[model samples]
Target: MDTTVANTGTEGKTWGGGNQPLKSSYGKMMMWFFIVSDALTFSGFLAAYGFSRFKFIGSWPIADEVFTHVPFFHGNYPMIYVAFMTFVLIMSSVTMVLAVDAGHHMKKTKVTWYMFLTIIGGLIFVGSQAWEWGTFIKGEYGAVQTNGGNILQFGKYETVDGNAVFKRVAVSDIAIDAHGERVEHERKNGLWFVDESALPAYTVDEVYNGLKANSDVLVRTQIINDEGEKTVLSREESLNQIKNNGKLVVQGANLQVNEYGTSLFADFFFFITGFHGFHVFSGVVINIIIFFNVILGTYERRGSYEMVEKVGLYWHFVDLVWVFVFTFFYLV
Candidate 1:
């Protein structure tokens, strides 16, 4: 008996494998799947961050205080630079959509230019994020790490128009070096070939002496009160705390210690933002690849610009993720 595959009348129908589900190409459908899975992953990360922040609500670092730096300007402008980065990323997404539209119209020149601008915007955003991370790691106003692993900041309460304004005092401004030669332990000089990290800008003794010299400045605890501000101690309490409890001068943030209130804040900030930045960088690279293809007339030869559309989906997803990150990390 001879047997051969025969298409019945229903062969051209949905159940007969002739239908394209969701009217999407195989590549586009796969891209959507990946985006969905990745979105869930990011959601989980943000959820974990939210739970962690809630757990340490009182000691959590204020986003406004922490991310208050621009590229060249050196004043306290809270969330301004982050807002700029967000704008750049969103504009890049807009350009990406325009490129996709140009591809649909088979406008090779327009696609090339738009894709180029998208790539540039992504690069600028990535560079801005890198600078922000560098500034975060190299903290502004140094704080003291207590023996119990608490971060104690220095600020003075001033009355302006009958209202109290807290003025932050930098450790560098107030710290005076006493007569001592403090040497960092280096690998070359240590026993067992051990290596040691670089020393901080000032020693704890110097900070204590500075606090003693400045009667106006007081120690601020990480604990937040009902008013959502760090608890400020009295002058005598500040002196006693620094003199007895202060152990190290923490100048910046790291995996080990953060000058900011809680180390958890720094951990989540670095992890979530770094993950999002990596996605942006990856999208930039893919855009570059597609951009060269557009210049080479690859999609034109194929008679379809679905490649641009696929990558456009990815770029939009990245931009959307960033909006959520900005909301959770900066605004909230």
Candidate 2:
């Protein structure tokens, strides 16, 4: 006996798997669903960042001061490299769009070239972000952390272009470390498994003495004033704070201490940006896979270029997410 079920009234209806409700293929629709879910995830993270930044509005690290390094030429070019990275990512999205358009026209040569450009753009962006991470980890000017966990940056007030600007004073320029023979705490020497990070380049005493010796260099407190800038203390106040309240010398950014400002700022920076960077890197890998397949004429032989369109959706979503990330982290 054959046990074949008869087709119900919904056999040819949208309820069956045969219908394209949104005028898209099953794969494209699923990609859209994934993109929507991922977007919500990013929104949650950025929302948390917004709330934290709002709570600590005053002492937040200034983006201009924080992202002031270029690859080779470095002279306080604030936001230049970051802007370039943004531009590159946006351009990659543009190239992806071109590739999708070419795929629609069945112009394989055009698709190949545009996809190649997109891959190049992605590589450049990922490399630039890695360089930025390195620069941020290896801080430019060292700072002294107060007993209250405040970051004290040394700078001098200089008149430039008819306005007074805060010029950062390098620790090496101002601090003279007389004490030598500093050793890093290790597990072998102490707890048999516990280990500590290397000591800072300068001791608190050295920074204090440097503050006292330099009359021009003043301490810029983390607190922001009504003028929308960090409150630069008077010379006398600067010396007094470092002499009495200075606890440890912080060199770069980490989970424990941040030479730039609050430790929470660095924590969020690392977590959020690192997550986004991972996404970008993943997209690049996927693009490379798809790129190779295109060269092999996989989609061409299948009589459909829908794979390019599907990946383009993901690439565009990634680029859109970066725009919001840029606004929150750098512009805002």
Candidate 3:
């Protein structure tokens, strides 16, 4: 039965042979409607993120610093790896479309090969996302402090060599327990797990002393020059001399984040990106099923590979969502 009809004598009509305006099998049409609604949901999230950016006014975490890491390297190179991952995802969408085209022509072998490529692309994307999450959860350069406990960033120097210097300070430079060890929960007794390796650098005494030496450093969350590059505050200006001066000592969750940075950003970043990644994963599974069905000649006997085309719609939509996620979450 030729279910497709061209220019039938009926106006404003699309039956199954002629789709009746917006009619298709319940599954296919419903998929489109569902996707449209979900897109709006994601847009809401992105918009809320933008609102937060405006609310912060002067202080906010710099995206470049937060998301920087080389794919495989000794030195901390950043951004290039995740950018490559974006390309990988877009290319996978292209492959999935090609598979759909092949299925339309009943070319079973072509469909199988392209579907395989699509699946591999999805796997690589998931791995890259995991790497990105790991890097974000861990911060860099540390922070500046005031007598009252407020933090300041060292973005460029008021006077370069006066007291502002970017050096790897140690946690011992900051705080030391009475036992001469930095205090933290015992990993063995922790309920789930904790990253002890990510312990802070520098001791309180070292930070205060460093602050005392640098008189010009300001104790705000982050520093912004005309160009907006973020710089860490000098040790002497921030911690050494600044204790007893009024500073915002944000702790726990609040301490975790602020206009300069926040733990909430990290937590939400991992959760949202992780959920979208899981969707790509499931899409790959559906692709594999379609791939084997083609190879096994199920479609050849069934006379149409519409199933492949259906799943292709889903795979491509997943790629589309990632594009938005990347732009809003990383770039902007």
Candidate 4:
């Protein structure tokens, strides 16, 4: 054992390889340690995420129904768009692995080309993430209720005869704080600076009153149906009950959302997904820097390109995080 150790030292000195500490370099070792800790950190996050999911298992909304918009299609398509996003990210992971394989063989040309492709893949994935975020923020179906608070879910029913199929209003539709004025937003004299559409449909005061009167309707971030068509119910009856002859007031960013789905749902969905998307963006930036270094022969001049390996590790770890995210956020 002593002779083997002595021989290793002698060989290292002969090769002027002192920089390669313990058969590796300071940077590579540090990167490995960082990766280990980061892996644990990511694991903790995923664990917490899973716990939250389980805690809210019954109330948790289905991801597919929530984000079902395609690139060019209308609001009817389900999460097919997001599924494409997952595929893009997974494909980028493959490209990154190939780039690392080229690096292992010291094939500089192949490494550069593969790395370039990997960067492109990462960029594309990030772009797709951005589009998804936009769709989520914009929102989709408008919610029921004049207060615009709470989601109204629907359930299917069969007539007692067993031959008739029908859908009833899932929840009461009472829009709260809807955009524009309940009364006309026109000037006292009838001249208007802004169009009537620009005004809020309902004021906050009216929304509060409506919510107080309704007891059967509940609110939520996303509304779904068990088997029948989920119709947006009107708060007309509830409003009429509360004020005898009062007109229902409703309108903007209220409890109701436009395209992506429910407004609150858009809020949480965008927040979580955007944060993850940012990580991918940063990873791509780092990859670009490493790609340039590989192109300029910086490592070749130094006699060792361990930096490439270090960055490769980071890339793979990013890919690893996405694996669990994809499963939980989409498939599950």
**Local distance difference test scores for all models:** 0.88, 0.85, 0.62, 0.57
Cα lDDT tens digits, model 3, 1-332, are: 22222222333444433344454443456577778887887777667767776775455566765666676675655467778988999999999889878877878889888999999999999888877665544444455445533445433344355884433332223333334456555677684576454333454454455444544433434545566754444544444334645243222222254323644455556656777888888988888888888889887787766677678778878888888888877787
Tens digit per residue, CA lDDT, model 4, 69-166? 78877755666776677777778777777777666566788878877887887888888887776666544433333233333332234576777443
Residue 213 lDDT (model 1) = 91
Q: What lDDT does model 1 reach?
A: 0.88
lDDT of 2 by residue, 1-332 (tens): 01111222334456453456665665677899999999999999999988888998988988888988888895878888889999999999999999988888778888899999998998899899889889888888989999999999999989999998889988878887786656788888788888887788888888888888888999999998998889999988999899989999888888899999998888888888888888889998999898898899887886667788889999999899989988888888
- How high is the lDDT of residue 25 in model 3? 41
Between prediction 1 and prediction 4, the one with superior lDDT is 1
User: Per-residue lDDT for 143 in model 4?
Assistant: 31
Between 2 and 3, whose lDDT is larger?
2
Best by lDDT: 1
Global local distance difference test of model 4? 0.57
Indicate the TM-score of model 4.
Answer: 0.64
Worst 10 residues of 4 by lDDT: 1-10
Ranking of predictions according to lDDT: 1, 2, 3, 4
Worst 10 residues of 2 by lDDT: 1-10
Model 3 regions more than 4 Å off: 1-25, 74-78, 144-220, 223-226, 231-237, 240-260
What TM value does model 1 have? 0.92
Inter-residue clash pairs, candidate 1: none
251: Cα error in model 2, Å: 1.3
